[model samples]
Target: MNHLIRIIAISFVLMPPVFAQKLVDPAAVAPEYRDAAEHRRTEQLRQRACSLKAQQAKILLRDRAAFVLKCMDAADASK
Candidate 1:
């Protein structure tokens, strides 16, 4: 019984790292964003997108893709 308790304690201690990892969304990501580096690149793109999008006075919520595309184009242009 003590052995069972020790095993359970060890399992609990070991499990948090597995469970604490971030969950990536497949559909929300583009194909090029599979790597961690690519994902980090998109954060800058998103920030640029937001700033560019904020400049427009009449941007509809449904038209966010336009901002993302423009941001991606800007990133590509810089590269």
Candidate 2:
């Protein structure tokens, strides 16, 4: 009876491992789902880049305007 109990206990411990091995691999995910995920990632990167570019452009424009205004003020003061 002790041997039978040990066998049952060992099987109980090993059974979950056998079940875990049946899981689907991530690489084997559906092609359409994978492609959609990739597309979303690309779109997110593109949007981030575009937003940063726009912010940089705004800063450049503001600096140019400030420099031009400073030059005009100097000219007015000289007159």
Candidate 3:
């Protein structure tokens, strides 16, 4: 019983790192498609960042969608 408990505790401790890791692995894609895959991953990450910014600024739900789009476009414009 003690061994089982220890294993369970260890599993819970290790689970977060697995979950926190990036969802997409561009290298896992075919070489010919890797660039496109990376671009998609970057766009998703950018969108999430914009959403987080909106949340931090307390932007309302109705306004958030537009704010996120504008934020992403601004980021693209700067790049």
Candidate 4:
């Protein structure tokens, strides 16, 4: 049990340096790559917003058509 505990403690100390070396700081990324990444993100957001707006417009048109049909039904019923 003591040997196992020592092994675990040694591993805990050694693991951090190995993992730390793999980390990439965002500021270290090259400028052209960062700019391209930002542009892609912005374009993706714009496309999503446009898609949502189009969906909303379709829903509004469907509702307007339903309202018009209801009015027509009322007119026909009154006659």
Error of 4 at 22 (Å): 24
lDDT of each: 0.67, 0.59, 0.90, 0.59
**lDDT (Cα, tens digit) per residue for candidate 3, span 1-79:** 9999999999998885545546567989999999998998988899889999999999999999999999999998999
lDDT of 2 by residue, 1-79 (tens): 9999999999898885433223234356687687666666655554545545556666575465555455445555787
Which candidate wins on TM-score?
3
Candidate 1 local Cα displacement, residue 78, angstroms: 2.4
For all predicted structures, in order, the TM-scores are 0.32, 0.34, 0.65, 0.34
Ordered by lDDT, highest first, the candidates read: 3, 1, 4, 2
TM-score ranking from best candidate downward: 3, 4, 2, 1
Which stretches in model 3 have alpha-carbon errors above 4 Å?
1-22
* Model 1 residue 72 distance off true place after TM-score fit, in angstroms: 1.6
lDDT of 1 by residue, 1-79 (tens): 9999999999998885545334455556867766765566567556655657646645676776676677667867889
Question: Could you say which candidate leads in lDDT?
Answer: 3
Worst 10 residues of 2 by lDDT: 17-26
User: Which scores higher on TM-score, 2 or 3?
Assistant: 3
Candidate 4 C-alpha error for residue 68, in Å:
27
